[model samples]
Target chain A: MIAVAQPTTAWYLILAALLFSIGTVGVMVRRNPLVMFMCIELMLNAVNLSFVALARDLGDIKGQTTVFFVMVVAAAEVVVGLGIIVAILRRRPNATADDMAELKG
Target chain B: MELFVFVLASAMILGGAVGVIVRNHPVHSALSLVLTLFGVAVMFVSLEAHFLAAVQVIVYAGAIVVLFLFVIMLLGVDQSENLMVEPIPVQRPLALIVGVGLAGVLVTAIVQARSAVQTGTGAGLDNATQTGDHDSNVRQIARSLFSDYVFAFELVSVLLVVAVVGTVLLSRRPARLPDDIGATR
Candidate 1:
């Protein structure tokens, strides 16, 4: 039977890195806080992907286990983050990250 | 088959990420984020992490994205934003440069470590390393989580409780000023 080579672990790692970089750029350049939060989610997912890939490659359950903890942390972060964003919006309607420069001093 | 699925999932992931950043409306960005989350879930399934894939869809795409949409609607900021405006003079250029540099570094590291990663000593004895007793992935994970990582698991629960309290505290409105004092101001 003819065999096909599966995609390498490096390929998954590279894709995760690319996704992480994109998320980083999005966070850096976006003026909207909500968009920035989405970028953070993208970054978390990227990390989760890499973790799963490594787990599969090494045949370890630890990596898969870590992804669960990471998800929990990400969920907590989103809750706190969106709450802060909502609070900011209440104080100043239509505020962007640029308008949040009151603490610049 | 695996390669095809990876390519499709990665395309959806990256495209959704780009959509999240480039879309003018926050609501559109939220929807794009949903796509990215679903794509990640697909990737999880491809990696044989079925439990994580289920949680990714349920918690991320369901609860988290719904929370985001609720905030977007509550704030009434769904109107399209002016994308041309850049309050920070060099933010976009700097971001692009840094992103490219980071990607290059990561790709280089992965390439250099490819051989070591593939032939490492920790390879599992079987393909289904964690599927003990023919139980599901979720069951095995729960076993390890409660037995070996119980402390960390309990700590996470505590952290979640604290997060809930913090969210409530942060979102509370400030005390209203006296009616008599408000008129003078």
Candidate 2:
């Protein structure tokens, strides 16, 4: 398997999946909005990793294009998302996400 | 050769995942996320997506994490003792059920995705006139963004501006509340 192409993409995909799961757990279990935000970034990166792998595998630039769009979206998302998080922290002084269920009731 | 680097990156990624969840302190969790981003960036490099790798570092590690830490510092007190942020209130059973359900779905999806693998011939990577080899390829990316995706980029700029204004507005305390007699004007 030294000179073989092998199944390298599988490893990347599995890593991405694991990272995605971790991000999900952080989102589900953690209370802090900032931490939640970080988890969201983690999830997005996991997607990005898979996109690159598929891009390389397909030999087309499309997956890279998708990653570029995702990156752009994520950057935009954080700027606005953090701004909202700051706003929330100002009012209730509670940065934990579970207690932020104002819209739930 | 490749296997060694892959192993190193995988270890780092898994360790970072552990730190992000297991750490009690929020600041420590952020540091763990930094580790996670580094691992993802390295993985990006390994994938031969150099540009995406750079973006991962600058955007995630540099910008997003900085904003996260800024929010953490702003919310919590200077000392750790004063930073007793309250825990989230939720039914534990419900949370566990939902989390397990989601994980099951995700694992299934990953396994299905793996079944569709078709290894590349690897030659097409070296030859593409649309995106010329190596250095000039980045320029092609920029050109594509400006020509094809320019409108979306501009929209993002506008969204950021609105966000800035909204954030200022949302955080600002009003001069008076109904119950307050001596609220600052």
Candidate 3:
């Protein structure tokens, strides 16, 4: 069992997969939009981990480069998404995603 | 040295993640998530990805989790009062089966890949003999970012700016609350 410690890069990828899936479940189970957003970030982070691991394995900088792009998009997502949530909350104090099911006022 | 660090960090990170999911209170979960993020950062460091480790702590634990806690407080969500008393639905069984199946697949994939790596597997491993100007993993990363895929870098920066503006618009509310729907005129 001690031999299990030295994981190949594939282990990291699998770990990333697990993390992303957990985030997906979090999004499904958690009712709060804020929590959902956090879960989404968790999913994005898992991908970053995958990119770094694979890049190292391939002996190339390409994966990390892709990760950088993903990071940028993630940053933007948080800024915009959280801002929108706050705005919605401001308008309707308890603005949950579950509550906003209607198409029209 | 490597073996010790990996084992300890992985155990801690995995445990923290479990704690976060098991805890019912949002505050407890958030705090456990912090531990998870920190543990993940340590794992990143072990993987020779220092930059990512830093980002993991600052972005995930420092900023993101803090923002989450703030929201929880602001919303004043009372799980005790607001908790759904519905019976154990189909979701519980489904979630369990899916989660366990994914874990099994992952463990199998990992075991397979470990047996497949060729010699001198990772670039991050430091060799004292290769002492030249280009000696660090960070330097290698910088070289790649500037040399190739530079266009993607610039696009991401633009995305950040757009996100900032969009967030403002999305969160903003009218200065005054109009009680009547027709009062906006």
Candidate 4:
């Protein structure tokens, strides 16, 4: 009988780092506000994965409980973010992030 | 079994992430994000964070992605953008370079220090068995949340209410056009 080594905590952390980098690239390269928003969601999920992994490693329930708070915050952020996107699109149809230069001084 | 599940979930997560970035249409990107979210939920379950896995599916895949689709439909910006067109020159290349660099640094750090970090402490699973109570993960989480972290929990509720109000105020459309302002008077 052969014993297979299980995946380690470091593997989870590495996966999270990879996911975070992907989200960062998406946010930078994608022009659409909605897509950028989705990328942000991806980034948040990656962070949540890290939290859960650490919680499991450390035997702490706090980390898992914190995931709940993070989820709530993420939901709120999506609502407000999408509302802003909708408002912008309502006034200017098919507006990309580049077109919103009104904030540039 | 665990190693196989981890590999499968990680592949799904990374594939979905790439899909979200590479897809030209917003709807496709949103669907890809759902895949990524589900993969994360699966990872949570494998980590023994069952409560978080459930919440990830319910709140993220269920509610948050629905909100994303709602806005995508309402805005009607489903048309695919030109991938070849670069509104900002050098943005894509720069992002790729930076992303690859970041991933390299992280992976290198983990590889170098892998042995120092302990694995399989089993504290999470131990909490349930050591006491002989056979309490579920959710119950343990509830005990910590309601007792030790009660104040922060209440604050999150308040933040949610504020977010709801802000979204309503921000998305409200004008009842009448500006040109109608003078005609009625």
Q: For each candidate, give its TM-score against the true structure.
A: 0.91, 0.79, 0.80, 0.92
lDDT of 2 at B44: 75
Q: Which prediction has more favorable TM-score, 1 or 2?
A: 1
Off by over 4 Å in 4: B118-135, B178-185
- The residue-by-residue lDDT of candidate 2 on A4-97, one tens digit each, is 4444676778778778877887777766677777778888888888888877887756577668888877876887777667655655575456
lDDT assessment of candidate 2: 0.71
Compared with the true structure, what per-residue lDDT tens digits does model 4 show for residues B49-143?
Answer: 87788888999989998888888887788889888888778888899999999999988997888788665553454344555665578888898
Whole-model alpha-carbon lDDT for candidate 3: 0.66
Q: What share of the true interface contacts does each candidate keep?
A: 0.70, 0.46, 0.33, 0.83
Q: lDDT per residue, candidate 3, B104-132, as tens digits? A: 78667767777676634444433224554
- How are the candidates ranked when ordered by lDDT, highest leading? 4, 1, 2, 3
Question: Which structure among the candidates has the greatest TM-score?
Answer: 4
Question: Which residue segments of model 1 deviate by more than 4 Å?
Answer: A1-5, B118-134, B178-185
Predicted complex 1: CAPRI docking category: medium
Better of 1 and 4 by TM-score: 4
Per-candidate DockQ values are: 0.59, 0.46, 0.40, 0.64
Off by over 4 Å in 3: A1-5, A92-97, B75-84, B106-135, B176-185
Residue range with the least summed lDDT across 10 consecutive positions in model 2 chain B: B77-86
Error (Å) of candidate 4 at residue B148 is 1.6
Which of the two, 3 or 4, has more lDDT? 4
lDDT of each: 0.85, 0.71, 0.66, 0.86
TM-score of chain A of 1: 0.92
Which pairs in model 4 have colliding backbones? none
Best by DockQ: 4
Ranked candidates, highest DockQ first:
4, 1, 2, 3
